[model samples]
Target: MFDKVLIANRGEIALRILRACRELGIATVAVHSTADENAMHVRLADESVCIGPPPARDSYLNIPSLLAACEITGADAVHPGYGFLAENARFAEILGEHNITFIGPSPEHIRIMGDKIEAKKTAIRLGIPVVPGSPGAVRSGDEAARIAEEIGFPVLIKAAAGGGGRGMKVARTPADLAEALTTAQTEAKAAFGDDAVYLERYLAKPRHIEVQILGDGQGNAVHLGERDCSLQRRHQKLWEEALSPALNADQRHAIGTRVATAIADLGYSGAGTIEFLYENGEFFFIEMNTRLQVEHPVTESITGIDIVQEQIRIAAGAKLSFTQDDIVFSGHAIECRINAENPLTFTPSPGHIDSVHVPGGLGVRVDSGIYAGYTVPPYYDSLIAKLIVMGKSRNECLMRLRRALGEYVIEGVETTIPLFIDLLKDDDIIDGNYDIHWLENYLERRRQ
Candidate 1:
């Protein structure tokens, strides 16, 4: 195990990583920007270092400052908590050059999976199902039109290196193709600094499903079932639940086995998610996240696994602690990403948190970094906490989640709590009958 680990990000995830390290008997070093000086993680860590100013580029994303912090603190490992440098292959390689361990997958795998075009190709080679579309990035509008025609109408144009829906466009017909391609490429260049874009056949009513897997980089891996993250707006997941409400036992087992086999064969290390779009009866691969996900708590709640600790162990050269046969999935678990945003307008709400009252119970958990007097800086992501609830069944889980949501309280800033409250009242949400586009449509209806 690492003697000391540096948490390379902020917010709830940083706090999450720190607690895991403390439980593992490892000392922790918290790196933060000036704006997060009063953050909860900084207070809990054994030691804290202010890397830079408020801007992410000068702070969390500043590689030099992070390296300096690690060097000064004598930290042997870095646990990037799912953003900033988490999946940056170059950052991982640089840490290696400095003899500092990055508690994530191999840089090569990160690079491959980070590129949407290459990720699709890799998934196909691994026997994973992918959507039918262009073989590679289209070079021009003409090439894009040809591929779209072959793939049929309603093709999706996506950035080869995009995420969070920044560089994605849908073309339902030939007339929309040119504009969609140009827009996707332009947005891709702005967001990822890569103009490369690829095509995929868009599924109209697919449910977002992802499988969580852990590997030892030594030919051993296990899948912890699937998460239904279909509820979204602007491609950002708002709610996630384990043992997807959409799949049965056989489907779960089959997909889990397939994902585990592929990860093991590839010698992947640490925690990763194989995301897919499921419609009708087939699953089409989308992309792979090479680090921990925000909704990992739901999977942990059902499987009784400590994903963060396991990531540390894997990075320290340990094999997987348990085999696939030893794994067992228990009750259903759901996680609602409580963001600091207005429920109605969906606009960012960053300000002082005068008080906080997180819910607690037998199967309820809240992972947050906010405190009574801490101010939620506008310089970072709006997510302030994660409310995860578990129950013997999905219905029970939803019931518990509803109660928990009512109990959660945060003052001095508007939150999306009201949005979740409204969602729980919908028949589609109650019946688990929502798809990827359901939330957007629901929100539109609410506005009207």
Candidate 2:
């Protein structure tokens, strides 16, 4: 076990990793930007270091400063909590060269899975079904048009290195393919510094389901069920739930086992998620997140597994604590990503939090870094907290989530709480009859 671990991120996830380290008798070092000098995680960590200015390029995303902090703190391992280098293969390789353990998967796996084209190829090789499209990246608009025609139109042009819906465009007909391909390539070049883009047959009204897997890097892995992350806006997940209301027992088991086995076969270690788009009782692989996901709490709630701790243990050469048979998933769990934004307009709300009250009860958990006086900086993501609730059934979980959202309060700044409150009452959300496009359509209807 590592004596000290440096957390290479901020916000609630930083605190989440800190708490896990404390429980495991591992000291934690928190690295923060100037804007987050007094962040909750920094205050709670065993030690803290200022990395750089508020800008992410000079701070959270700066690799040299992170390495310097680790050197100064004598951190034997680094835990990148979600974003900002968590999936960077070069970062993992750098840590390895420095003889410091990266509490995640190998750099090879990260490199392979980080690129959409290679990930899809790996999925196909592992017998995981993928959306039909071009065999590889199309070189020009003419080639893209040819691929779209062969795939029967309605194809999605996606960045090979994209995420969070940045370099993606959909073309429903041949006329739209050329422009869509060009725009996707431009966006991909700007966003990821890579002009490579691939095409895929877009599925309408698909439910986004992802299976969580933990591996020991030696061909041992286990799946902890799946999460329904269909509630999205602008390709960002807004709400997530475990024990997906969409899948039956047989479907869940089959998909879960297949993902676990494939990842283990590839010698993947630590925490990873295999995401799929499900429609008409078929699952098509979209991508794989090679690090801990933002919506991990819902999975933890149902499985009672400390994913962060497992990541650390795996990095320390520990075998998986349990096998597939030993794992038992419990009741339904739901997580609402509370963002500091206008509930209706969805604009970033960055300011001081005057007063706050987090609800607590059986099976309700609030993971946040904001306090009464914390100022939400506009330089980063708007997510402020995660409200996770679990219950014996999906109905009970929804009820608990509604009550919990009502009880959650944050003054001096607008939050997505109102949005969730309204959503809880909607027939579609309550009945779990929503898809990846459902929330956006609902919001659009309200705007009209």
Candidate 1 local lDDT, 238-332, one digit each (tens): 99999898999999999889999999988899999999999998999999999999999999999999999999999999999999988899999
Clash list (residue pairs), candidate 2:
none
lDDT of 1: 0.94
How many Å off is the CA of 348 in candidate 2?
Answer: 0.4
Against the hidden true structure, what lDDT does model 2 obtain? 0.94
Encode model 2's per-residue lDDT on 1-448: one tens digit a residue: 9999999999999999999999999999999999999899999999999999999999999999999999999999999989999999999999999999999999999999999999999999998989998888887888888788888879999999979998899999888888888888999999999989999999988999999999998889999999999999999999999999999999999999899889888888989999999999999999999999999999999989999999999999999998999888899999999999998799999999999999999999999999998999999999999999999999999999989988999999999999999998899998999999999999998899
Separately for all candidates shown, the number of backbone clashes (residues 3 or more apart, or on different chains) is 0, 0
Q: Please give the TM-score that candidate 2 achieves against the real structure.
A: 0.99
> RMSD in angstroms, all models?
0.6, 0.7
